[model samples]
Target: MTFGQQLLFFFSAVGAFNGLLLGIYLLFIKKLKYLPDFFLGLLLLMLSTRVGISVCMYFYPDLPRIIPHLGLSALFFTGPALYYYIRSSFQQNQFDVRNCRKVFGILTLILGAVGLLYLFFPVTWENYFGTFIYTAWSVFVFITVYQYYIFSKQKIVSHNKFVLPVLLSNVIIFLTYQLISTGWIQVYCAGGSLVFSFVLYANFLILFNKKYHQVAVKETNNRYSNKKISEEQADNFVSRLERLMETEELYKNANLKLSDLASRMNMSAHQLSQLLNDNLGKSFSIYINEYRINEACEKIENGSYLKIEEIGYEVGFNSKSTFFSTFKKIKNTTPLLYKQSQILTEPRFQSSNL
Candidate 1:
């Protein structure tokens, strides 16, 4: 490679390498258990892998066949990671964790099958499978943008300051790849990698700004600003809270986060937490999980056709393990055994229903 090309590769490759390290830090080293952070780490890792491949092929045309395959494989997950990160960062019912995991599982099987084919028929993978990957990536990018459009239209986008730039950057990268794929631009793999480098660093600055840190600190300081509520106020708040739970069935939403609930109730999250802890003597999770477990018990006793996991999803628990453990904690037995006991004691419910 000429010096110019080598320099281009160095700058671009540096970005990809730095992004990889940052991604690893967020995924494994970060102490916070934030779901958005996890998804963002996965996104950065996938994008870095894809860009690294471009950097290699741009500099080394005679690279091993496996490099291209791995690059394209990473592209498959890149779009999904972006989609899931956006979904996880928000508290909308449309972006349930259960659905996110379901889509991820489907994508895994797809890429797994494609990977096996690539191992045996390299030419087919290059000609057809590569196109499929680009197509899938394009579709995912479109879906993510469309989903964001819906959120924007409904005025439900709380974290747009962070999400918009990511969406825009991915769209540009997608457009660049499409241009190259369509032969509009030739031998611009390095250009795409360069764009990834820019996007990755820009995201780093945007996400890790000092302003966000101040926000976190301010929230912590304000958590106990005025924790005490009068008896009448507490009674009214509880009544409204219960009414909302019963009528709106907010607990049915798998993405009904504590912050979102506090916003709906016209209070800060800390205030809500104070009320929950001081007055109700329960943490937010236990309170919400109690409702979900009760609903699961009702569904199990009703002899619903849905599987146990499905029941968990229906009651707003994101996973079967959470539902089962919460059920055991509250009901003192497993769901299946509880169902059997109910059936034995009330045989009419079993016979008359079906």
Candidate 2:
């Protein structure tokens, strides 16, 4: 009838539908670890609880209140769940059950106790918690963004194609939400003033689901079809190759080839080549040189007695020109420049001496 009523009905429909999708994801989707699944479950519960509260607020304002600010209470878990969900999605094997369960229990107790208290004494509570929860979530989000920034600057997060989309989605969700809340040109909700959390919620669900499937497919591929080298095995092999290259013994082997490294590791040349190209995200020549570049940088910084050329040769680089080019490509700077700029040196070598 009224604008507010129409807005309320619209949100109610979105809330119910989101709750249904979340329920399906939780009940049916198999996870690699309990933490991710647990976090997802909590996330869904929060969405459902918020939807219920919205319905009551819109239609039955006079009904006995069980949870004052149920929607706000749900917002409290949003940040923590989001953080854990992203982490678990990336690192399925390292997902710890105890820590995850403990965090979930603590949040549940805090929110559930507050909800029950509000139900019994609805007049005692206030709306200050809403702002508090948002501020807290903002802090969590910024921390993750900062970590990603560090990784990018260090060149550790090389796949900017994937990372950028994920980060952009989060930024969009954050900016859209703030705009909707502030009543500054609403681009999301159709009916009225109430911001549709469901849109952002669906965005997150899709993002996390994509990440989950990526990990799941990799894991499944590794388990089956021993005849063909799976994606996960290739990834694991590259990790092992990196670790092997870290050792002084391994780095000393100049003129090393894919077949040579494969022989050392007891793997076939085809497998190693495929692993380097597909999973490690580099060609064989580039991958090997990147490792050498890292080693050369370390040696140049710490072992001041060793000449740059000597260090480069020891790390499997054939010539000074090749070493310099590879180092620049991987580190985004020349070996000499990187050493002078990044490495910790004695005060005697400081710019003041110049």
Candidate 3:
């Protein structure tokens, strides 16, 4: 083989080894045990197996033909596994067997289709069919990337800086492999493996970092669970939480999250959520909005002379419609009507005082 081919082979081998190590660490060494971590491990395993086989097939062309078919089958899992990994990482839902089954079922269908095509068709026809399958996989990657983009904008999940870039790298690598027909497939494959290995290692370092572990440990301990707390304890906790909010005016932060508030109260997000739901009979949104709406009411009554929308922004409502709806819902009157009532009452108060 030429020097270029030798270089590709070396990179591919290194990538495969790195992937294997990362898969093991994700599956075993990572203590968080989140569903995303499991899916990520599966993704790495599939990637390593697929890349390793590709390299082996190139180096030793006489290998059994079935091996390549198996590698292609593994390719079908990459897109879906990555999609789920990102979704499960950002989402708060616990692992659901039904979701896992759905992903597995899609993968099974793809593999079965590819297997049947290989069995019945000529080699050239099988290659063509495999191309179509990979094209579909590329589409899957596109959709998953789009979903991640939308989710990031919603701010409902913690953003991982590496997830999007890693996913886009897959899309780019696959497109490069498909589009460049001048025997550059090996180059793209080798480069892709290198990139994937780098991302996996970086993610491993981030996940198992000392700071992250310490924070996770503290958060796990504080997380609100079924742990029994006395009624008095619950009340005291609520009082402290309320004082923190009132004194700090945390509700004024438009982007404030339950977790953020919980941290300020020196508790877990789940605990704060439970306290609001069980003790206060409100969700976090309602609790925060109550403070905001009350502040808006005072501004309106005092004739702050600001536009209603401006007042909404001042009180931490991100949008005008939300401010109007929340105010109406809680106060049972529009902001304008409330202001009018206050204006009418002020004259009566002055006359009575006179």
Candidate 4:
């Protein structure tokens, strides 16, 4: 190969090869359980395989035909993985890892199906696979851009500003290939590889920027610490929790834990804690105590034979002092005073108590 050709090969090959390595590291070596990381790894793997195959066939046109087919198979899922990576990145922390695994399973089935067709009907694949792959890719890119537009319009609090470059990168790579395929750009056979390498490294630089990490870490922490769930989400969480409380009387168990409540709500313990603190404007303990205090009030009104002290234990409090203090704070009166008021208002209670 000529010197310029060698240079072209070296730069493009480096990006594709290193992308493969990074993809493997993120998928297997990195221990993070975050959904975005896993999807990003998969995206990288797909793109790397696709780009590597493009680079090889462009430079050495006589290579095995199966090499291109292998790369085409990767293309089948590339768009889906890209879209998912962005989606997962924006998802709330409660987005379950199990769900992501399910997505992965579905994508794998798609890839396997495409591979089977490629194997059994190579002629059909050679004729139509490229159109299907590029069309899928273009649609995903458009969807991603549309997502950015919606997010920007709503001013959704996230790192979507970073997505702009990624969107542009993919657009450029796609256009480059489209131009070459249409014979509009009379360039080297590896022109698509050239753009792919450039964009791939641009993404790498964005990822490695110190300010990016600082902002990302800060934003993530700030989200959990300060950001409340959307009103809709908050309402949904409250309704679900209320239903659980009414049906199960979970707070009646003195040993009831935050994790237990969160599990009932299908959320993480931290998510429930955040919900209580930010959305409900209370701590988990206080939230549960409010339920207990209300239950205590109902018991007092019902002319229960048990004394206030026993009623406290019945409701869930561990001690007389705590129950009395919490009742006064919640009800704005001592338990006995509150009970006497109930007796005065409700003749039945007075009759039963007397």
Best by lDDT: 1
Taking all chains together, each candidate's TM-score versus the true structure is 0.63, 0.45, 0.54, 0.57
- Each model's lDDT comes to 0.80, 0.61, 0.74, 0.77
- If ranked by TM-score, best first, what sequence of candidates would result? 1, 4, 3, 2
Q: Write the per-residue lDDT of candidate 4 for residues 1-354, one digit (tens) a residue.
A: 999889999998988898899889989999965566777788778888888998999889999988887787786666667676666555434235687679668867866786688779988788666676677677877787787677667644333345567667767877887787678879875777778888888877886794676567545655675555788998998889888787757776665688667656766677789888878889999999999999999989889999999899888887899999999898889999999888787877567899
Error of 3 at 168 (Å): 4.3
User: How many clashes in candidate 1?
Assistant: 0
Give the TM-score comparing model 4 with the true structure, all chains together: 0.57
Best by TM-score: 1
Which pairs clash in the backbone of model 2?
Answer: 66-119
lDDT-based ranking: 1, 4, 3, 2
Model 1 TM: 0.63
How far out, in Å, is residue 183 in model 2?
Answer: 6.3
Clashing pairs in 1: none
TM for candidate 3 is 0.54
In model 3, the runs with Cα more than 4 Å from the true position are 1-8, 28-32, 94-96, 159-162, 172-176, 179-189, 198-354
Q: Which residue pairs clash in candidate 4? A: none
Q: Write the per-residue lDDT of candidate 1 for residues 251-289, one digit (tens) a residue.
A: 867667787677678677787887888889999888888
Instruction: State model 1's lDDT.
Output: 0.80
Off by over 4 Å in 4: 94-104, 159-161, 207-354
> Model 3: clashing residue pairs?
none
lDDT of 2: 0.61
